[model samples]
Target: MREPAKSKAARTIEVINRLAKAYPEAQCELNFANPLELLIATILSARCTDRQVNVVTARLFKKYRSPDDYAQSDPSDLELDLKSLGLYRNKAKSIQSCCRRLIELHGGQVPRTAAELMQLGGVGRKTANVVLGNAFNINDGIAVDTHVARLAGRLGLSAHKLPEKIEADLKKLVPQEKWTLFSHWLIWHGRRRCYARHPDCLHCEVNDLCPSAFRFD
Candidate 1:
């Protein structure tokens, strides 16, 4: 007979223990000095790597240190500055619009709440969560990125596919204080071990607790 499913609490504890031991220093990989920089980086990170975002932002951050700088920048120049990233034109527009709103509404500062942050042009639930968690140290909700979503499914922490539903499921399973860290752990694990096409299950630290382990073997 097939074994009974593990209790949500039990599974969560097991998963957390293994991942925590494996990646004690797991955190957001995107480099940013402040909330505004983080907000801009997260927006530019859509369908892009954190390394690329950091490389671009190193110069972008120096050039546009304040919301007013971005708000007043020439769109063409901004697009040219971000030409290295995919979807540069759209990202530039979003950044310009978001900064303008920031200046108009929050007086050139990043908003502290998800609701308000989402009101910005390029900001969404994921970006808002990243900023709130890392920049503001608020564990409002988990940022369900591609890595988190994939690992959540593989680990059986969440059966849902959509980010919103997956985040909801994760919220129920993970502790409130760990919301932010949980996303980071999963993201780190996904990037390091649980690849999309071929997961390194044999040497994976959470293999024992992971139901999908060694399916390739």
Candidate 2:
């Protein structure tokens, strides 16, 4: 049976509290110093791990210090620099095109709004939310990454399969102030405890609160 909205909201708060305790230091694992660097790193992170993205960005950030740097660079050279990532060619093109858009439209600055950010190449609602919440501290919306999406369903928070729908469901339950931190908490839990294949429900802090707990065992 579907849970009542009132009870579900209460459970959601408890889940967030438990997750907060479990992952007190959880935050965006993607390494970046500023909004622009974050924007570039986020674009490079498509289908790529944060650790790998960070490894590449350590050098890439040094080379391309600004949108103009990426916009003006040779496409071949840029692709070569990002060749280690999953979709290097496509990501390179997207990054260059995105940077050009930034230069031309936003004055070479990462836009603070999700709508503006989404208009850029290789960017969608998820990427835009990530940038807005993490880079600009603007809680326009939650970022429903794979981890967040999986955890949401497993926790009985949302039945929706699409990220937008899941995010919409979460936004209703989670408080406005903790929007960004809520994503971090769920992501950390998904990574460390509620893994895709073999979630450690036995030791999971929120196992009692999770309706799907031990179902995979």
Candidate 3:
């Protein structure tokens, strides 16, 4: 008699369960008090760490509390305020443009659906997914950042290189209720353990279940 082959869904569930236990307190690290704030934060998070985004938003959020503020803001002034973050000029433009659309289309509130949110300037699928999942508690799709994409391939959860394809692969394996938390867990783990280089697999919590575990060792 041979051992049974583990189904992809079963393997994913086991991985999720272990990760949930390992990171019981895992959540979105980006600080935001509202959907609009989260939307802005996510846009600024491109090529920037959550810590860096939070630092800039601390003052930025205080200065611009509403979509109207951003819509009314001077582009040069906004760029100056966001100078600390790389690509400040483009990000500032997107923020202002997105806010303008919010004011003109949605009355200055972040849209709840992914489709509506994506229509805003600078709000791509990844950013829209982040706002939808973390801010609105709507699991429209998994937020596939660099970390998620890397972990998905390493853990054999997804072979797709593109975030959208990876997100689709993950959505099929992980349960809908766990979609939001699943992304969070992978992100937290990627930052802490399964790093892009020099992963510390010696103490990885899910090493036993991870097919790519210790490949670097």
Candidate 2: count the clashes: 0
What TM-scores do the predictions have? 0.96, 0.95, 0.97
Q: Tell me the spans in candidate 3 whose CA falls farther than 4 Å from its real position.
A: 1-5
TM for candidate 3 is 0.97
On residues 1-217, what C-alpha lDDT tens digit does candidate 2 reach at each position?
9765558899999999999988999999999999998888888888878989999999998999999999999999999999999799999999999999998999987888988999998899889999999998999999999999999999999999999999999999999989999999998998889998999999999988999999997
Any runs in candidate 1 off by more than 4 Å, and if so which? 1-5
lDDT minimum window of 10 residues, candidate 3: 2-11
Q: By the TM-score metric, which is better: model 2 or model 3?
A: 3
> After TM-score superposition, what is the CA distance of residue 64 in candidate 3 from its true location, in Å?
0.6
Please give the CA lDDT of all the candidate structures. Answer: 0.92, 0.92, 0.92
Q: Judged by TM-score, which candidate is best?
A: 3
Candidate that beats the other on TM-score, 1 or 3, i.e. the better one: 3
**Where does candidate 1 have its weakest 10-residue lDDT segment?**
208-217
Tens-digit lDDT track of model 3 for 1-217: 9878678789899999999999999999999999888999999999989999999999999999999899898999999999999999999999989999998899887889989998999999999989989998898899999999999999999888999999999999999988899999999999999999988899999887788999996
lDDT of 1 by residue, 1-217 (tens): 9888788778988898889989999998999989999999999999988989999999999999998899899999999999999999999999999999998999888889999999999888999999999999999999999999998988888899899999999999899999999999998998899998999998898887787899866
Cα lDDT for residue 10, candidate 1 = 88
